[model samples]
Target: MTLHQLRIFWAVAHARSFTKASKVLGLAQPSLSQQISKLEDDVGTQLFNRNRNELELTDAGIFLSRKAELILSSVDETLVGLKEFAEGTRGVIAVGALSSIARILLPRAMHRLSAEFPEVEVDIHETAPAEALELLYGRRLTMAILATDSIASSSVSFHQTEVFSDPYVLAVPRGIDLAQVNDVEADLAEPDRAVVNSTIQFNFGSQHKRRIEAWYQKVLPHYRVIGQTRTYEVALSMVQEGLGVAVVPALTACVGADQSYDVTLYRTSLPDRRLVALTPSQYVRVEPFASCLRHLRETGDDIALPHIEPGPPLMKAL
Candidate 1:
């Protein structure tokens, strides 16, 4: 019934165990059990069915869990709003972003933000979209910048603003021409053409992964995946070493020094990866976060990608 009890129950439900939830909340297990018992006694209905080692939420527990999320979220927002009256634009804003994308965007954005508001501090977590979304939901991150395609469908609600859009490009070894070579088997020389047929693929589960696979199958019919990685840097590094080619976003190759990659990029017909900043609606209007988001948008707009060549007709067919 109490807000404290509701928070304990919510944490226990999500963690699925009082012991685990105790560790997460930095509270004693005995205290958590006592609180939950008090809450269940007050409600006059069993919320959780204690099964030997595992905890299962009852029908009522399931219902209350959903409501508890909303109530706690609203309460957090109220606190944030109240604190803003005293702090104004001086506070820490923890952000989660893809490592490759963050390198290109955050530098310029943080520079502008610092120049305007010296008291604002940005805590950046370079992570994949799935992990970023998790951190956002757990209240560990103030905002998350992610590619829409990379994130799985989720029930959690967030206010999203499109920050960057860049086309997927074919990363090949430098000096290997794909401009006029439609047929991979016949166009390029032996041992070298083999590299083009060998793909360094992205290893991840998402809607985007399927699309990338389908594109490869359609364009490079004879291609075989020789390497796989979850990070763009690894995939691009494999391509740079002449290990194999990869289909990656243009910005992935443009991170830091363009020459450091030592790979040539060719355009792809696949849809562009749309990057967006996801935040709770309440945080959108809060200071430091508001100015931080503005600078991110400005930096995204001013982005200039490295040189990319046009793919051959067959690669562009899709």
Candidate 2:
């Protein structure tokens, strides 16, 4: 008859015992029984068959339990919708991104978001760009910051905002001597003479994979990729151990030397990387969504990206 009575009835029906339901509802067993009895009287049917220590829901009880579940779930979802509508500043926003980007960029953006809008919460999912896009399309994430070159064909439509461009950099062991290549530009132009033979590979997708392979053929003809990794940090670490040079996006390299270890950076002439923010078209202009994007662009603009220097192993970037 009442929502409260329905709640009690549903709990007991699921628990299958008056005593168990009483414990779950934190009510006295007799009080719980009385309420259910009152409800059965209102419905003009027996809701439960109570045995000594066991309980069974009658046909009516089973029907009501199913109805209660639907009612409660709908009520909960409605409340969440209303809360989001009224409060543009509060609640959680789910974001998916590459781990390296999440490390370097997300930290700063989250800090700023928290400082400016204390009520909102950011939930970050560290994943590959392609996988992140899948999550975005699936509605698991509201937004994703990643490269979009891998999504070949999909029915999912999303609005992509290019936040920044990242260049490819070779992560070499710090101890390697670059004196062999007198003309740095010429060496990258012809990989046949580039001295570093061992290399580490970071695979994003088939398209990215083929592009990297082409770059290697054009720049490091004699080089052999010793190991394959999914993350730039791992590739950088392998390079630090004197394994081989790793070609990674500057976005990952600029994450700092902690994960990079003893790796030194070298500028490569390969295609520059694209970093984009993909959002559902409907929410792209919405607040907090709009403000979150503003923070991303702000941090991106101020980043001190590293690059290949002419004289040494490090180059300053935008």
Candidate 3:
């Protein structure tokens, strides 16, 4: 079938509404219907089933949509590559990053890439750690920055360049009296304290709850934990609101002039987490992109840890 037909089919499958897909594709509803009908005729199967108000992809449609996405993505990449080749200088690089890295590392990296390799067009996609890994495997992303805790699939090779690492810090509300509190015990002792009251108001998940429990049981057996949250920002916001103390990665809770809230960062004995830059083994040999990565390892201070040493130099195989 024609590329146009595949495009129409894919859009319809994704939006699950013929009319909605028509609006997105900027085509008349009739024309969109005709395209899908023709594609289904050519494939000799129905692609979707229409319920009263919703559309569901049939088994065949689900399979075809996956392949269509790859085909379109490949075509787009090829066009970008050809354009870069014709320019005879820097190449196009597609980089993916987690939200945390996008906020802290990407802006600086983009500025440096533009200044040093003006001709190389850089496209940055911000997504979750798991999603970034999927895009990397699909060849949609040339490289990515993600948490070290995330598992890299077999299709991807880990370069292990540490981008940022920071130890967890205990953040308490600005006006809280910690003089009497030796550890978590003193903090937890005043369950009726404003901080503890605030902590009980917020929801704490299993992982964070475990951390709080461990802190009380091992680190400070007498201290009581009233609340916890997965989001670092949320915990910080709570601290600002006179809520209970929160334990968060130091990199995420750094305070500056822009911060209006009153909070203090206390060094904690918890284990630190590392953020790593991951690249396809094939692209590691590409000098321009590799150089940018090297610079980050050497100079990025978004995280509180020491500068990350570059891993074994990339061997050029191209």
Q: Rank the candidates by TM-score, best first.
A: 1, 2, 3
Off by over 4 Å in 1: 1-59, 87-90, 257-260
Model 1 Cα lDDT, one tens digit per residue, 1-318: 999899888778866788767765668999999999999999999999999897899999999988988888898799888777885545788889978877888888999999978888789999877667656655678899888876555524778888889999999998787778877887889888899889988876666678888888998888898978988999999898888899999988876644447899888988888988998788888777788889899989988888888877767567
- Candidate 3 vs. true structure, TM-score: 0.58
lDDT of the candidates, in the order given: 0.83, 0.71, 0.61
Every model's TM-score: 0.85, 0.65, 0.58
- lDDT by residue (1-318, candidate 3, tens digit) is 887787777667756677767765668989988888888899999988978786898999889977976676566545544654665665767778754466666666767767777777778887656556656544557778876655444423445567677776566676554434434433445543545334421133345457645653553333444555545666678777775666666655544323323566666666676777887554454557677787667546643431222211110110
- Native-referenced Cα lDDT, model 3: 0.61
Top model number, TM-score:
1
**Which residue pairs clash within candidate 3?**
185-223
Number of backbone collisions per candidate: 0, 3, 1
